[model samples]
Target: MNPDFPILTLLLFLPLVGGVSVVLLWRSPATARVFALLTALAELALGAWLGSAAPAAGPTGYFLYQDLPWIERFGIRYTLGMDGISLVLVLLTAFITVIAMLLSWQEIKERVPLYFALLLATETGILGVFLSLDLFLFYLFWEAMLIPMFFLIGIWGNGRKLYSAVKFFLYTFIGSLLMLVAIIALYLMHGAQTGSYSFALAELVHTQIPYTTGLWLFAAFLLALGVKFPLVPLHSWLPDAYCDAPSAGTVVLAGILAKTAAYALIRFTYPLLPDAARAFTPVIYVCAVVGIVYGAWIAFAQKDMKRLVAYSSVSHMGFIALGIAAWSPVALSGAVLQMVNHGITTGALFVLVGMLSERTGDRESLNYGGLWGKVPVLAFFFLFFNMASAGLPGLNNFVGEFLVLVGTFRVAPGAALGAFLGIVLTLVYTVRLVQDILFGTPSQPMSVSDLSLRESATLASLAVIGVYLGVHPAPVLDLIKVPIALLTKA
Candidate 1:
């Protein structure tokens, strides 16, 4: 632990503190936006510092670890730490939050103060989730993420806002409850075996239990995570919520919240319940392949841009899940990398889509045509990220998706083949989407401006990240390799 500065604590609470201050100060709307942006930038700077401070190339465990007693009676503590994998994720969270805040600058009008406040609070919750080392603390942060997001959607969303918000809440809430039950069960089991009560994740990881008991507990955790990962059949709530939420909310939802499920599988589920994870691998692999094909096929049928991208996410996230099911070191490492890749590509897509909708007041593919001529810069960005999302070479998504496919194929050739088919389907739908919006004949006389300086700045930053990940992802791969190696070896 670095005693010189409590960097983790600062990262965890700064946004929260800034959020409260924003609300209390609550001056002009412009003031709110500037303050939120500054706070978000500060978090980003701190995240960069943490990344720089991390071990460059080693199987180092958690750094800047702070384990302090919180609930002495129950053996819970305010435990926080970050390893290679977590450091990258923390950086992604900070980057996306800053971009999301800036993207919302003009789009969010009503209750601006409250909107930025919620955004900051949500950032805090997500940061906490990525950093917490205690199961109890993790669960607290897990639910903490939901409250502000629920309000963000309910208050600032478009049509069907209230319905979508409630549905999102209900789905995630039910999942969280199941996870809580599993957590309690684990706590009890650990206490019985070790003659001590503790909610620390590291303590729980060493727990010994019967295969039968572990299987049921793993199922409970998987069910909760499945809903969030939103594998086929369980993904019904996502379209409505993603399509209806404000664009800023959609960026966070797709970019960060959805990825949390994949992260949890790596961080907690696999390590703690290795046997059950292996036992369940086949079924999970099937779901992943199915989701990939299903989401791509459904995305081809969508007319609304937001809904289309939402379904595309279902397909893309399947790749992450597939890598996890493979359980190979290569696959797990690829999955971690894909988590960050998806955040950058998908976050960029949402921002671009939001910019278009903000100007034209419509997001239907049918309503747009020859956008390339009207807003060439927007068209260029749209195509760039579209291709990136399609896993084009020399782009971020390609690197992660390729690694995932290669790693999975080594273990599950049949499942990998199915995923490959989904990839082809994805390319088709992506091109169709781009052609419909950017190259087709106009439905009516069109008038829209190119990307503004602020919007261009956001897209450019994401583009740089995409290219960096595609061409030179070693930095990220290095950071995550040891942690992933540990999980795979376990």
Candidate 2:
């Protein structure tokens, strides 16, 4: 909380250090688990503290700014900063990391230490992505996070684990390479125009780019981030990766990893190439609306719970994309809020799905029936999160989606109408899933034992957050108001 303290650096390194420690204590899985949880808890505490401290935004609209020279010749620096947008995501990343560790505690048995280590390492990479102010540093973190995630899916995953891991890697890596090219192009162009080469975001945002060249650069950036956002046609890898990875891995993927792409779109692409961004709005709106409807429609036909949830993410993310594409202050605020809401609600759904799988060794909706009679507690949590995901009136997701629709309607009624259909489809699938899993007669004998204390506590914490955010989104809206205004005005 100290004004002069390097809190961001500590936050950035804490997980890396913990990961290393976890690796060192590989011989003792128990010790490693305990250590890893403590590290995640510590990081979450730091994030909360930073949020409460509420540092003032600097001239560049960043707070807790830290800049140190790194590869000065290229004008790359170990630069990190936070803003209202970054703060919420930092908190989401920290909170989700802890949730992931908890979810994996029992699920990941073999190579336990390595699993926790990878989770923490991914956390550091994601935090770096959120915090880095230099494009080069951001890309470094961007690529670094993929390795552990690849391993997470490849090693501890189920069904088509290797295939899914490879697909996830290739999709993200190829996109990243394109983005790398774009970053270098932007750097060179800025240097050519201003006689100074820099990958500093603050510097590049002021670059004078030709419209044609900007379009290409923006497309490159969009291709890279869209893959991660898994925007419609670019989302092929999501269902596989989400369905195959272990529950903890799936939670991280659905919860926070995808948000990084949305974050990048807002942070880098839109700001660095404003003209290209505006020019691409129509295209983005089309993709967003298509993804919303297509993802929801596909989800309705899914029999597997994991796959359903995975597809639902594609739908929810589409809604977020639509908001961003709308590019209004209200829509952007909603998008930011929905980012957190999706992280909580969808993350909880995935967690509950994992729990159900653990109990029944199955994830099929049809295979599960009358769970309410068998495991009332688990059924309650599952239903609660499903409604949250469905954007029920008083739950967390409704507020975000409502704002997105309202804002998009003002700008593009057609897109808003399309997204509204996705919402209706969302409710349809949600109700079907609820009825199939919770209300029907048992199709087969399954484990009737309910949630453990730890599982209950985990779901309880997320549920409480969803309720609070749903009822009191004013605080989060206030937090993001200035940043969204800056972004929309820009």
Model 1, 1-490: lDDT tens digits are 3566667899899999999989999678999999989999999998997788654443446656778899999999999888888889999999999989989999998899999999999999998888888999999999999999999999999999999999999998898899999899999999999999998888999899799989998998898889888888789999999999999999999999888888888899888899999999998998999999999999999999899999999999999999999999788888889999989998899998899899989888888899898888889999999999999999999989889999999999999999999999999999999999999976776678898899899999999999999999998988887788777887
Clash list (residue pairs), candidate 1: none
Candidate 1, overall lDDT?
0.90
**Candidate 2, 1-490: lDDT as tens digits:** 5667777899898998999988986568898899999999999998998888866776556777888898998788999998889999999999999999999888888998899999999999999999998999999999999999999999999999999999999999999999999999999989999998999998999998999999999999999999999898999999999999999999999999999999999999999999999999999999999999999999999999999999999999998999999999989999999999999999999999998888778888888788898788999998999999998888999999999999999999999999999999999999999999999766777666899999999999999999999999998898777778888888
Question: TM-scores of all models?
Answer: 0.98, 0.99
Which candidate should be chosen as best, given lDDT against the real structure? 2
Q: Which stretches of candidate 2 lie over 4 Å from their true place?
A: none
Off by over 4 Å in 1: 1-4, 55-60
